[model samples]
Target chain A: MERILAILVKDRSGVLTRVSGLFSRRGYNIQNIAVGRTVEPGVSRMTVTVDADPLTVEQIVKQLNKLIDVLKVSDLTDEPAVERELILVKVKAEPGRRSEIQQMADTFRAKIIDLSPDSMIIELTGSEQKLQAFLTMMQEFGIKEIACTGKISLLRGSKVTCDMKI
Target chain B: MRLTGAQMVLACLEAENVEVIFGFPGGAVLTLYDEIYKKGFKHILARHEQGAAHAADGYARASGKPGVVIATSGPGATNIVTGIATAYMDSVPLIAITGQVATPLIGSDAFQEADITGITLPITKNNYLVKDINELPFILKEAFHVANTGRKGPVLIDLPKDLQAQEGEFYYPETVEISSYKPVYEGHAGQIAKAADAIKKARRPLLYAGGGVISSGAHEELLQLSKMMSIPATLTMNGLGGVPYDYEYFLGMPGMHGTYAANNAINESDLLIAVGVRFDDRVTGKLEDFAPRAEIIHIDIDPAEIGKNISVQIPIVGDCKLVLKELLRRLQPVEKTNAKKWCANVLEWKTSKPLHYSQEPGDYLKPQFVIEEFYRLTEGNAIVATDVGQHQMWAVQYYRSQKPRTLISSGGLGTMGFGLPAAIGAQVAFPEKQVICFAGDGSFQMNSQELATAVHYNIPVKIAIINNKYLGMVRQWQELFYGSRYAHTSLDGSPDFVKLAEAYGAKGLRVAKAEETAATIKKALEIPGPVVIDFQVDPEENVLPMVPPGTSIVEMIGGE
Candidate 1:
């Protein structure tokens, strides 16, 4: 099963290394991860997706919480949360296939971010499933290059993950 | 007052009430050493960085204070890696300060430059690279705080050369406020109630105590709990002193080289109250077969350790002292009449296949006999440290440690060179107490250079080298599993340890015969300074009552 963990950690040097090192050392496979500064100063939030069983995922969260730099760890996998992933993909565009690709992008509500003589860059921001579907559809048009900002998530309502007192 | 970073380090140490530091000086830490010299804290110069680190660990284990060690950059920092890992494995509280190259030259490959924090990240509980001079005091405080609290492991502080020389305001915090690093000292009430209920209902309950009982000073609580419940208790190597060996409820250590009674009792237990013990492979020979009929309740300070190896039925995450006290408080004293049958059965097993060795007249000295003589002479009052090997097993088997913190050995890491330096540190911590190192010939040579350090400091430590002329443990393994092919386990050419001790200005003795063992040990004890005794025992002797690897604990051999 895939589990989503939201971790808030002290913004210090080598913290990322520590987290990643722990993942590798413990053999936890990280599917995707996104890290950014949180509202609290000197604190950063990381949303990591890992493929593991509930027992292993619980162990992972417990181990993460053990790190001194890590403040709080929440398993948001089963929570009511809004998850998003942003992807920019450059697709090959011939004179005839340009309208076809634009029509496909329009159906997915993606916008054209950049254009060149031979390629068109489409930008899409949505849930992981929608992005995966869009990428699958664009594969026939020849995906020249693709870049993705891995999944970042938040609770649906007023349940803030980082509001806990340290 | 404003002070240099080095001065702030000294101030932090003094504020922490650190009486002595084990260290080796180098170019990167010259300023810190100068400050230490000026401030005049007792510092013992170790021959090697590893020796210094192990000594610090020994001091911490023996004195219940965080041991401190200092070293220079690059090689010096790397040399302490084994010591740091050893402490980490055993959960010893240690503060290791290593010098780094100048801040500007940190990544420029300058002389003696090493990314020590990066190198030690996996081994240390926490570490810091102090780039800013002003953060030195806070970093030092945090280092001590992290090292001494919770699970208690080694913490490192990398002091760059330039930062040590830079000026900073010296304000030592009276209290460290690490919000995320709080350890749960109190067990949950519901969990404690559940454990007590299980204990009450259990017909064959066993208390499996580990190092945490000793580390938390919960020996009295453990004894009280055992007596109140009339529960039989078995100890791990680290938990040796948690209950006196003479205690009726006490079973000997349980594991690979454990007693037949302890192993059989564990095999037949119904409720296992495991406290502060991580079920290491040596303890549980075959995980599936271990305590098969028992419902296990694990109490540990580290939550990750619970259910890590064996499936724990009820997990309590708290300090052993606190949890045991709570359990004792919550439960009513039970009648021991119901447990009388179980105790009688355990006693039958104990007496049926007791730990025994034969020593005929005009025979060579047996290592077990030597340990027994030492125990009889010292009355089990000395702090005994052992290097990893058969001698260590013998020491654990024969020497009955009656007090907490009296037996300090490298149980987790099993480092060969740990005993001598650790003894030096223990002696330094408690100058009035007798400190003895039960070392093997193969293990003694690893850090034998520390003999000079002991002599120089006038540490009255005694080294009892069990000279079997082979890596006895490995030889035993080879003999059992590999058709007696000794391979490279033979120590054919080793130093003359007695002469070596004499060369370092210490008393030396050699006992080649069984009759001479008692007199030699007494003679060595009478020496006012460090003494080394070489006991040339039979090389073929092996630790008996062995559970062949991967077998159940009940499947022990050589007991009869």
Candidate 2:
């Protein structure tokens, strides 16, 4: 099962290495990870997607909580939440196929962020499913280069995760 | 008052009420040593950095306080790596202070500079590299707090020379406020209730205890719970001293090298209350087959340890002492007849396959006999530290510990050269109590230099070297698994341990005959200074009740 874990950790040097080192050392398969500054000044939030069984996932959470810098860990997989991933894909496009590519981008609400004579870069931000579908469609035109920002997520409603008393 | 970083270090240590420090002086740590001398904190200078770390660890284990050790950078810092890892593996509370190069020269690889924090990341519970002088006091305070609190382990603080020399305002915090590090002490009522109900209903129940029972000072609670429900108890290697060895309900140690009764009981029990045990591979021969019929109730302070090794039926995440107390309070007192049948069966196994070795008036001394004599001579009142090897297992099997915190050994890392330094620390911690180190010939040589430290301090720690003339444990494994090839296991060029002891200004005795074992031990014990007694034992003897690798605990080969 694929599980998403939101981890809040102190903003200190080498903390990222420490957290990632733990995952690698324990043989936990990290599918994707996105790290960014949190609302607090000296804290960072990391969203990690891992493929493991329920027991293994629980072990990972507990291990993450053991790290001194890791402030909070939550399994967002079962929670009602909104998740998004961004991708910038450069697709080979000739003059004749450009129109079709533009129409497809428009349908997916994606934007042509960059363009060249033989290729066009399309930027898309959406749920992982939407991003995967758009990538599959672009693969038809030969994706020359690709980059992705791993999924980041937020819970729905007023279920605040950051403001919980530490 | 303005103070140097070194002064702040001492101030924070004093604030934490640290009475003694085990450390060695080096160029990088000169300023800190100067401050230590000026402030007059009792410091024992170890012969090696590793000895310093192990000594501190032994002090902590004996006194239930965080052990303190200081070392210089580069080689000095790296030397303590083994000790740090040993302490980390055993969950011994230790605070290691290392002096680093000047801040500006940190990344440049200046003289005597090593990234001590980076080197110790995996081994330490937590570590800090002090970059600013102002953070010195807080870092020191936090180091001790992190070391001594919840699932205690070693913590390191790397102090740069420049920072140690720089003056700063030092303020030791009255209380640490680490938001993420609040350890859960009290067990959840719901989990405690479930545990209690399981105990109430269990017919064939066994209590599997570990070092956490000793670390949390919960021996009394464990005894009460076992007595209340008549549950036979078994201990892990680290858990040996938690319950008195001769306790009626105690089933002895379990897993590899475990007694037949303990292993058989674990296999047959329906309910296993595993407290503070990590279910190590040595303790669980084959995980899939370990305690096959048992529904495990794992009570541990670290949530990470609850289900990491085995599938726990009931998990209580809290301190062992607190959880055991809660379980005791919530549990209903049952009649002794409840587990009478099960106890009878366990006792039968115990009496039928009791631990035994040949004593047919041999020429050579038997290590087991030496340990037995030591136990008899000490009357089970001494603190026994041991190095990792056959002697370690024999010490655990033969020498009975009557109280908690008395049997200190390097269980997790199985580091050699731990016994002497650890005994030194134990002696320093309790000067009136007798401290003895049971070391193997291969193990004693690893840090035999510590004899000098003991002699200089007049620590009076007795060291019994089981001189088997081989790396006994590995030789046994080779003998069993590799057709007795004995590759690189022989200590052919070992030093004369007695001469080495005398060279260090300590008393030394050599016992070659079996009949002289008791008298030799008596003489060594009567010595006022540090004493090393070398007992030449059978070289080929192996630890019995052996569960081979990848085999089930029930499949034992040797004992009886």
Candidate 3:
């Protein structure tokens, strides 16, 4: 199963390399990860999606907590949460299939953000489930290229009061 | 302030309030040692690298601070492997530094080109391979921080020769930001509640305390839990004296060679509240039959430690001190009821005299007599370090270690020849207190070269060698398991230890009779230059209270 973990860590040099290196060294496959500074400066929050089992995820969480700069980390699966992902795809739209591709993209609610005479750039944002459905539908449009920002999450309907200092 | 790597090392040492470091001179570390000489920091040059490592370990154990050790590259670096591994197993905070080949020649297998980082990894909590002097102060700062924190194990820094030679605009960071390592501090409320509920429900509860309790300084919390809930407590050898040995609820050290009282209580416990212990094989004889009737509640600071060995009903992963506080909080409203019947049941299993050496008017000295007399002389206040063997067991069984962190021994690793140098380290760490060492003849032979180090430093450490002809533990195993085959445990030929000590310019004494131990020890302590007393103990005697491998914890055979 693919699982995503949201980690809050003190932002510093080598922190990203250390965290990623740990995953690689342990041979725990990481599908993708999105990291950026949070509203609280000097603290970076990362969402790591890993192709691992529940036990392996647990082991990873425990091991990650052992590192020095990690402040507060939680695997969001066990609790109520909201998760989202974004994907941008550019597809070829030949005259023979231009109308067909636009109709297909419109069906998936993927806005044709940019359109030229021969191709369309489509942007989609939704829950991972909806995004997967849209991506599955877009496969019929003769896809040219795609880029995705992995899952980002927040606890559902509640504010997270994170007070840990590095 | 601008400084060199060597000067930064001094500053780092100053930050940690380090008083002395144990090391030996070599070409690579010459500049660093020269810096030490000019800066006026106390550094004792040991005869061998292992001796320096052990001395550092002893100092750390005695002072409750990380011990610092320095050595040059190649053979010198390799020499401390056993010592590092010993500290790793026993959780001693030793910041060890090794001079490596210059950064440019690191992987080329240059002269004295040992892969120090790779070589030392298995023995260290963590290691750093520094290629630049700019990172030196920061690394050293981090080294001290990491070495002295989070489980408190040895950390190594392999400093290359060029890195040491180069100067840097170095400043020590007040703190480091290591993003990957975040240790848990507070115990979860839910887990604490579950633990309290276990205590409330169980009829026979045992609080199994380990070294981590002492390390966390959780004695008061442990005392509260034991008294408030009427939980009987048993300590591992490392956990001895965490609670007063005289407490009604206190059972002695538990394990293979555990006291009858301790093993019996462990067997009878309905709820085993293991606090800060790893539950090593020594404690749990056979996995299946151990704690046969109990629901194990393993409360450890490390999450990975939970359920690593014994299955647990409640696994509380948090600091021992915090966990104990939460436990006390949970039990406040609960009424206290003494497990009087259960305590009495464990008491019935105790022997009249737990450690009695023969007073049958024999001339041959007994190892027990030396420790028993040592205990009497010091009143259990003096710190003791021992190498592995029958002598180490006798030190634990005989010496009443009333103070926390007083009894230092190589427990899990059981490294022979650890005593004398460790005692020197302990004495250096605590100059006001008396430090004693118990060494078996075989174990003494391993690091006896440090005797010269002791004399050179003029550290007042009392050394007592239990001079049996053979390696006592191996011989005991041979007797019991291999039909007394006695393959090669004995030291067939060796120099007389008394004569050897005399040659090293230290006071020496040889005891032939059991009656002579107290006087010999007293005289040794009184004399100035690192006294050595060779006790000619009986060769055939064994460290009894042996629980055969794969047997139940309660089924140990003890000496009457």
Candidate 4:
């Protein structure tokens, strides 16, 4: 089973290594991970997608809680949350197919961020499924390169993960 | 108040009330050592950094205080890795302070520079690399806090050389609130009730206690629970001292080298109340087959440990002492009549196939005989520390420990050279108590240089070397499973331990005959300072009541 964990940790050097190192050391499979500073100072939020069974996920959360730098971890997989992934796909666009790529991007609500003589960089942000669909459609034009900002998520309601008392 | 980083380190130790430290000095830690030289602290200089780490670990286990060790950078930091891993595996609270290269030269690969924090991240509960002077005092305080709290383990502080010399304001935090590391102290009420209900309903209940009982100081409660419910108890290797050996319901150790009674009791048990123990592979041979007839109720402080190996019917995550107290409060005391038949059955198995070894008049000295003699002489009162291998198992079999922390050994990591240094640590913790290091010939020589440390400090920790002339445990395995083709198991080139002891300015004794074992140990105990006794026992002797690897605990050989 795939699960998403929203982990808030102390913003310090080697903190990321501590988190990622834990996954590698404990033999947990990380599908993807996205980390960035939160609104508050000295704190960062990491959205880690892991592939594990329910039992293993419970162990993963408990083990993550044991790390000193980690502040909070919430399994947002089953929770009502807004999840998104950003990917920049540089498609090899010919002059004749440029309009076709633009139309495809428009349909997926993606942006044609950059256009070159030989390639067009399309920026897409949506649920993992939407992004994959957009990439599948763009494959016909040949993808020159692709960069993904794994996954980031936030709860839907007033119940804030960071505000919960340990 | 403003203080040098080194001075602040001492101030924090003073605040923490750390009476003594085991450490080695090097170029990176010179600044800290200089402060030590000027403002004196009780320090024991171990010959090797690894010995210092193990000594600190021993001190912590014996005293229930977080042990502290100091080392320099690179090689020095690496030397203590094994010791740190040992403490980590057994959940012993230890504070290891290692001097790192100067801050500017940290990543440049300067002389003696190593990424100590990164190296120790996996093994340590938590570790820090102090790059800023301002974070020094708080980090030190946090290191101690993390090491001592929850599921205690080693915490390392990699102090950069420049930071140790750099001056900073010293304000040790009175309390630390690590949001990520708040350990649950009380078990859930519902779960506790469920556990109580299970216990009440059980006809043949067994209590499988582990090192957690000692760590949480819940041994008394454990024994009380067993007595109140008329239940029998079995201990793991680290849990030896959790209950008095003479306790009528004590079924002795359970697992690979466990007694026939303990293993069979578990096999026949209706319910098992597991306290403060991880179901390690050695304890649960062939996990699915373990406790086949029982419903397991596991209570551990660490939530991750529960259901890790064996699924439990009831799981309680809390401190063992508090949970047991709650459990005791909830359940009504039962009369012995309730489990009389079950108790009689267990007692029958215990008496029928008791741990025994034959020693004829002209036979060579048996290792078991030496341990039994030590037990008689010490009267189950001494703090006995042991190195790994066959001697360790025999000590577990023969030495009856009556109190928590009495039997200290490398239960998890099984580090070979742990005994001598650990004994030194235990002795340092209690100057008046009798401390003995029951080491094997292959094990003692690993950190034998620490004999100098013992002599210099006059730490009267008797070393009882069960010189079997072979790595007895491995040889036993080869003999059983590998066609008795002993490959490089001999310790033939081992130096003379007694002469080695004498050269280090310590008393030395040798006992080659069965009759001489007890007298020699008595003589060693009477000596004022550290004494090393080399007991030449039968080399072919093997630790029995064996459970071959990947087999069920009930499937045992030589158990009867």
**How much lDDT does each candidate structure score?**
0.92, 0.92, 0.82, 0.93
Point out the worst 10-residue segment of candidate 3 chain A by lDDT: A157-166
lDDT of 4 by residue, B199-295 (tens): 9989899999999999999999999998889899999999987889999999889999999999999999999999999999999999989999999
How high a TM-score does candidate 4 get?
0.97
DockQ of 4: 0.69
What does candidate 2's lDDT look like per residue over A56-113, in tens digits? 9999999999899999999999999999999999999998899999999999999999
Clashing pairs in 3: A66-B181, A67-B180, A67-B181, A67-B182, A68-B178, A68-B180, A68-B181, A69-B178, A69-B179, A70-B179
Error of 3 at B184 (Å): 1.4
Q: Give per-residue CA lDDT, model 3, range A76-153, as digits (tens).
A: 776687888889988878778878877877787778888887788889887888887877777777678989998888
Candidate no. 3 TM-score: 0.80
DockQ scores of the candidates = 0.70, 0.74, 0.21, 0.69
lDDT for position B255 in model 4: 94
Residue lDDT tens for model 1, B355-407: 99988888778999999999999988999999999999999999988888989
Q: For candidate 2, what is the total of clashing residue pairs? A: 0
lDDT of 2 by residue, B40-105 (tens): 889999999999999999999899898999999999999999999999999999999999998888
Q: Which regions of candidate 4 are displaced past 4 Å?
A: A164-166, B336-338
What lDDT tens digits, residue by residue, belong to model 3 across residues B1-560? 77877787888898878899999878778878888999999898889999999999988887788899999999889998889998988788999999888888878988887877677655676688787788888788888877877677898898887777678887778888665555677888898899888888887888999888877888788888888877778888788777876677777788888787778778878999998898899888987888888988888878867765666889988889999998888775444344667656766665452545574576567778778899888887789999988898888888877777888888879889788888889888888788889998999999999989888878888888988889889999999989999999988897799899999998889998887777777888778668888888888988878888888876776634
Worst 10 residues of 4 chain B by lDDT: B331-340
State the iRMSD of every prediction, in order shown: 0.9, 0.8, 4.3, 1.5
